[model samples]
Target: MVSRILVPAARTAAAARSGLTMRSIVRGFQTSNVVRQEAATVVAPVKKPVGAFRGGLFGFLLGATASGAGMYYYVIDEYRVSNELLTEDIYALQTAVQRIEGYVRTLEEKVHSKKK
Candidate 1:
């Protein structure tokens, strides 16, 4: 009695396993067919010409030229301002040196008079 019951249970399990395997195989084939159809229906291939790339490069260079011109003017203006400051500093240093020379001369004359 136990053997009879066990046999039917084993057969049922084997049938279920085969059904699952068949479903998986069918699903795989269907997926592959759909992918093939999509690949065929998609747009055609086209090559881009070298001129398009050259034009892009030219535009980039033009932009860089304009930007560089603006930067050049800014640098020139800064240099002019810096040159003015340097000139002012030089004049101040000359004035200070002259004042120091006069003070040295006065001290020397005082020393000479005392000695005489």
Candidate 2:
């Protein structure tokens, strides 16, 4: 009850001492447009970034080069691994065929010897 009144009164006194009351704030806002207009007449508009297009192009080229190199490395590595596996498979198949040929020749020699 009394506290509410005292609080408002204290705030008003403080605002008066600080020169920051609502009316003064509103008056400042009313005067601000004139300052803004004067500043607008004195200052230049901001310019666009001169290097923006060049920077973007350089970034795109760098990304493309990196992606191309990565793809080339991946393909070369895959091919090397695939070729190694194929060579191993071919070597195993050749060894198996040689063993089968040896057995067939041995059986043929036995049959020929039995004929005599």
Candidate 3:
């Protein structure tokens, strides 16, 4: 009779310990799952269409400004080249006028000498 009672008490103690261990394991898993869910919620950012639109607009404006700057540089370069050409032409005309005046003076002197 004493053996029967001791065996039942021992089995009950072992079963209770196993149940407690299983409960602890289940609780740990639940806690870990909750922590993971919370971390995911905190780390993930929400996307908005307006933010995307703004970024595209900013990029387009930057491209437009760059193109405008390039056009301005091209126009300025053309103007500089034209001005240089005009200055060279003016200098050539002045040189021709001086040569013509010298030739006229020489012709007039020769004609007077022949007449005298």
Candidate 4:
């Protein structure tokens, strides 16, 4: 029982010492940079100004791109709706054709019976 208690306490003491030593070692390496100002005057960069033609062309292109994207999505949605309607019409036609085939079979049977 004594050994079990002492073993855990000894491990905890060693862990505490190691953690303190590691923090001190990190603190010893910390440094602050010293900045020296030599030049009193700062130079400004030269920038070209945008002309009226350049600004107008940029605005026109931006508007055209936005409208083109919107029209593309609208066309896609319209195509999907039209495809759905066409599929419905095709299914209706298929059902009508099947019904006509049934009526033809019945008429053929009646004519056969009369001949017999």
Candidate 5:
């Protein structure tokens, strides 16, 4: 009873004599509390969500790019296959033309022999 009252009264008197506050004393004894700071108002910046129009545009562009690439590859493959087929046909036509020339030359030789 007397001790409780006297002890608190003595502590207050000693604190009054000292200019430092209780918060400063506690911070001095703590390792993590090195500085004194007041509470600050925090403001978080928020970004707007993507709109439907933007999403659709991006999707359209992506799809167009993918399909364009596929068509390009398909056209290239067709060109290669057609070129190979055309080269084979050209080789066949060249062989046929050689055979015809040989036959014509033989006919001319026979005509010459008959004339002589």
Candidate 6:
């Protein structure tokens, strides 16, 4: 019976020494002089959003520049492909015309030989 009583008493003494008692916990939450003074005389600044393009000045210019560059690149690439196709077509037409001319010359020579 004495050992059981001493065990709990020892635990309570150890808790008090380690500052785990109820009185210490209550004192920790009590306001001090510095905290009270700072709270009484504090002012917070009002935050505002930065309005660099809320008036639509810089945003409009940037968008226009990007659009113009995209259009220029697209036109240049389109014309490059079109020029290549046109060159190939012209070469084919020239070869066909030369073959037709040769056939006409052969027919003319045959007619002269027959007349002779």
Best by lDDT: 2
Following a full C-alpha superposition, what root-mean-square deviation does model 1 have from the true structure?
9.6
Tell me the tens digit of each residue's lDDT in model 5 across 1-116: 44445445666567668975444333234333333332233446888989999999999999999999999999999999999999999999999999999999999999999999
TM-score of each: 0.53, 0.52, 0.55, 0.59, 0.60, 0.56
Per-model C-alpha RMSD: 9.6, 8.0, 10.8, 16.3, 10.6, 7.9
Q: How many residue pairs clash in each candidate?
A: 0, 0, 0, 0, 0, 0
Q: Write the per-residue lDDT of candidate 3 for residues 38-79, one digit (tens) a residue.
A: 877886566755777898999999999999999999999999
> Model 2 shows how many backbone clashes?
0
Q: Any runs in candidate 3 off by more than 4 Å, and if so which?
A: 1-31, 43-60
Question: Model 6 RMSD to the real structure?
Answer: 7.9
Q: For candidate 2, write residues 28-65 as lDDT tens digits.
A: 22457888899778867798775988999999999999
lDDT of 1 by residue, 1-116 (tens): 44435445666567577874323332232457888999989987787766978999999999999999999999999999999999999999999999999999999999999999
For candidate 5, the lDDT comes to: 0.78
Q: Across residues 1-116, which tens digit of lDDT does each residue of candidate 6 receive?
A: 44435456666677688878644333234788999999988878878875877748778888999999999999999999999999999999999999999999999999999999
So what's the TM-score on candidate 1? 0.53
TM-score of 6: 0.56
Show model 6 residue runs off by greater than 4 Å. 1-25, 28-55
Mind giving the per-residue lDDT tens digits that candidate 4 earns over 1-116? 44335455566577677774323332234333432233324457878999999999999999999999999999999999999999999999999999999999999999999999
Query: What local lDDT does model 1 show for residue 8?
Result: 56
Task: Order the candidate numbers by TM-score, best to worst.
Answer: 5, 4, 6, 3, 1, 2
Q: Scored by Cα lDDT, where does model 4 land?
A: 0.77
lDDT score of residue 12 within candidate 4: 55
Model 4 misplacement above 4 A: 1-45
